[model samples]
Target: MDYNKVKEGISLLLEGLGVDCNDPHFKESPERVARAWTDELCIGLKEETFHLTTFPMTSGDQPNMIILQHIPVKSICAHHLLPFIGEATVAYIPQKSLCGLSKLSRVVDFFARRPQVQEHLTSDIAQYFQHKLNPQGVGVIIKASHLCMEMRGVKHSGLMTTSALLGCFLKNSTVRAEFMALARLQ
Candidate 1:
């Protein structure tokens, strides 16, 4: 990300909005926004360096779902560039391999760092696992509160959006139910 470019854009945006950029309080706002974007909102770009380690399968040849729930996600909406914050529940039934628990979070962050719609984000994670692990099943669910909706437009409070992708999880009702049940619990 080009910090200078973003700073310039923000400066112009503030000027367009008729905000006094010369004011002491507003003078550094552009730089600060650029810094915040690089540090917090856009940090997922760093995930390209993430590497998953190989580990022995512990499921003893029985395909079992590993569900990680409530993984916190904070992202910017592509349409409005406003914040979208929420939880992601991910599950995969290993075929012959499994990733470390923490690596799953890294995978989530890898995709979350980019500007996205919730539907695509959910599907992307599921597809990543499907391609990488070729797992027996992969399920992903994302529930988020979009600041664009809450802080603008309709301005409705407590509005939440959800999206999901169920792969092999879709073929078996019992597995799908179990995944949903796990996501709902606690």
Candidate 2:
């Protein structure tokens, strides 16, 4: 929200890194990075962007499992301020209501845009739909490769997987199994 402050801070960071801001190529770099962070990476911090509209189920509507898979996950690692890229699978069983199909992916993007650890991001998205929809259950699974780990210490190239299950998804083995199967998890 404070564009000027962010620009100033990024300028200071460039200076601390011994980069000359006066250089032709670097002159606008601070403003550009600051704007990119606010407009892209930190967009989720704004509450207005999280509005999820739901539709009521009719008598003809049957309660069933709904799964959205291969939803892209792009987030910054909170610890090292690096990037993590992956996909997420979100599933839930209806309980008298259903949200738009695209809303599931929007929810994922909402949390992903914030600087966060994969674990918390998984849990937050699960909790959001669980609380908002009061569904029979909610399940979330994420698989991502973090730049922090890949580009630094140990330099190991490995994917990290995390999952969160709530309500029936947590209590019922069959339900959990089905979700994981649909998500293509081993």
- Highest-lDDT candidate: 2
Model 2 / residue 135 / CA error / Å:
0.4
Worst 10 residues of 2 by lDDT: 43-52
Error of 1 at 177 (Å): 1.5
Query: RMSD in angstroms, candidate 1?
Result: 2.0
List per-candidate RMSD values in Å: 2.0, 1.6
- The pairs that clash in candidate 1 are none
- lDDT per residue for candidate 2 within 1-186, as digits (tens), equals 677898999999999999999999999999899989889888888756467799999999888899999899999999999999999999999897899999999999999997989999999999999999989999999999999999998789899999999999999999998998889943
Misplaced by over 4 Å in model 2 are none
Residue 50 in candidate 2, Cα distance off native in Å: 2.2
TM-score of 1: 0.89
Against the true structure, candidate 2 reaches a TM-score of: 0.95
Can you give the lDDT of residue 108 in candidate 1? 86
lDDT of 1 by residue, 72-179 (tens): 888889999998999888898988887888878878888898787888888888888888877888988888889998899989867365655556698889889898
Error of 2 at 105 (Å): 0.2
- The C-alpha stretches of model 1 lying farther than 4 A from their native spots are 58-61, 159-161
